[model samples]
Target: MTQDKTNFTSQQDRLPPQSIEAEEVILGGIMLDPSAMSRISDRLSADAFYINAHKDIYQAALRLYSQGLPTDLLCITNWLSDNGLLFRIGGRNKLASLVDRTVSAVNIDVLADLVMEKYQRRQLILAGTEIVQLGYATETDLPVILDEAEQKVYSIASEHSASDLVHISHALADTFTEIEARHTGKGSPAASSGFYDLDNILGGGFRKGRLYVLAARPSVGKSALAGNLALNVAKTGKMPICVFSLEMSTDEYVQRFLSSESGIENNFLETGNVSDSQWQPLSVAIAQLSEQQIFINDESCPSLNEIRSQVRRISSHYGGVGLVIIDYLQLMALDTDSRVNMAQRVGEISRGLKRLAKDLDVPVLALSQLNREVEHRNDKRPVLSDLKDSGAVEQDSDVVIMLYREEMYNPDTPDRGIAELVVRKQRNGPTGTVKLLFDHQFTRFKNLSRGRSF
Candidate 1:
């Protein structure tokens, strides 16, 4: 009797954790009511089934439902036969068994949850085993192993959080409500960069879950523009803006903010040579900025993974990080063991930044330096192609703004001190240029005054 019990326990352990009865119920419900498939699609997938026959049948049902065809018992059987999977899936007899076992279609969602739960448990077992193996390995760095283990678990969690589709009518109703609120000035809309003309051209403001790229040649004021936007967003006090400066120090960033806020020359502030008239504005600027919520990190080099982790930490403190600004894109790092080209690494970094924005549900304003090729051109206007290192930078970006100043090329031109905010690529709106006055002394960008033509 003891030997018999041991044999039974061994057989049970050999079988992967799964609920075959629940899978059958889910498949049968879909056959009984085609609409049941739509309700459970987001919660379960074919791989969730432990039995081969059940997996094949569920796949067929999905194909039929997706093709706008019925998923009734006969249709699924015929689909399996036509696809040459019927015999492999235990033929018609097994299909009939599923229909007989299912009592009702009302609890399809509940059955799907059961199947998903079993599948996740199996996944956890596998992931835990891998972690154990990694713990035993002595060659790999402990930190790297830990990172990989965390990523494995995160992937499972992320997969379970699949998005559900909303009906068009419901989506439209929500949009209409938002519009009404905006019309009445009742809603606090997405944060803007505080430049009215630029915001107006952008259809309101920098929306959540968007990646905006600002590229310019050296000294054209991309970093300054990023700082200006950061300061403006923080001034609202609705949410904090986190700026990661790879090139500039935190002190330099703060000084730029002070000069921009006080309309005082950075040179005067840097040397503590402020005039009597400038001291009052400086003090006021200090007081105003000290009241706002602005976070800055001037880490010289950080990988994409590190940046994501840091952003998540900062976001956990308050409502969340409303906006993320990276001083430049090319400065960010990526991990790769294989021999990849520079452009490919840059592409990976760009795509990672876009994913980070969407995952955090916030706008990421990343600065980039334009290629030197722009200088050889006659116009010297930076274009989308000039985004250094990778073409994916353009492909992944929702909006691309380039900075142009003819004064840099020709000091005698009347456009001196005027920076052109060129909307080179806008996915959801028109592309045009909005001029802003660039005061290099204060390291600030301001909306051009009305009736003052550039």
Candidate 2:
């Protein structure tokens, strides 16, 4: 029976990735200085420790701290013993040994980091093992299996790097700090869209961690406006902008940008019929644009996962992303079950993009197509209900803007070249309409001047 037991134990052996020493040191540091846990309480989790006993101890300490109780060695040991867990976690002797081995809490940060690193490594190995098994299995479809595998891997990365909740007091402090900076001519809360009137309507600019939806009917130039905004943000040189063009190709967007920046006609550039006088401006525009930190991804139908991954990659390379623009929302591939309705699917995408904006701490400017029902109306201007596929787009967005141009419907009207940017809904400011000049030849939109007429 002893030989059989030994053989069974040997056969069940597995080497899990861990750092037991680091876990012990972190726990010890916490016991040494109760405040040590406060420094990394948000960063560390119970699952971060490889040893079950250490995890339990850390959990207990966290509970005490959260309840405003002491986390000293005596308090923790007594609590553990009273809860009938001291024996399971190796009793008072093991607890004493941890405190004895620790020198100070100064190195807690390094020790906590080591523990987290080992936890992530173990998660990676487990995910990889599951992926290998899936690769060998023939039960599920390959694409489905790969999607699940990617989700598992990305979830681990996200969980370890996610942000913590902030108290309202801290948020208020940040708000007042930004206000003071603006008052002293230092900075604003968000990046300006570069249109004076629109910026004023938006109460400065596109605020951070907001989802701005720009919806318009076909041929009303939502894409053109989006491109103009991207160019304007790039010109600021404050922070970089990333554009995910699920509809337009990179070369196509570049041409539109050139036309807008150089004051050249789009058709003229398309046909290569630019006069010599236009050549200098085109060259200058190209140089200026090339110097700005604008990145474009022309993926035809990217899922939300792909967009998030790309955003992270760009932020890593450029320090951070100032703005993220998706050409139009409908083109984005929904990351949900196919059995769901179109409205529900679009709602999921809208919610996901909003969460992404908050997670990345950048504004997401997503262009969307309005429903065709506006065409039958006498006014012909879009409203909140005109948002296609989902009202959730209207609900989830911090700002919902619709573009309207009367000249498109009535060519004889004197208001030619004038476009209306109707701010139908703004969570933090007033909602109204602002006019701009739409230069169709250049495929650009510009702020309307005081006494200017087309």
Superposition TM-score, candidate 1 onto the true structure: 0.69
Candidate 2 error regions (>4 Å): 1-22, 29-43, 103-110, 121-161, 333-342, 450-454
Provide TM-scores for the models.
0.69, 0.83
Question: Taking the candidates one at a time, how many backbone clashes does each contain?
Answer: 0, 0
- What TM-score quantifies how close candidate 2 is to the native fold? 0.83
**What is the Å distance of residue 100 in model 1 from its true position?**
20
**lDDT values of the candidates?**
0.83, 0.84
For residues 229-281, could you state the per-residue lDDT of candidate 1 as single tens digits? Answer: 99888875368888999989999999999999898989988898989898899
Best by lDDT: 2
Local error of candidate 1 at residue 321 (angstroms): 2.4
RMSD of every candidate to native, in Å, equals 6.5, 5.1
Candidate 1 lowest-lDDT run of ten: 1-10
Range of the 10 consecutive residues with the lowest summed lDDT in candidate 2: 1-10
Maximum-TM-score candidate: 2
Clashing pairs in 1: none
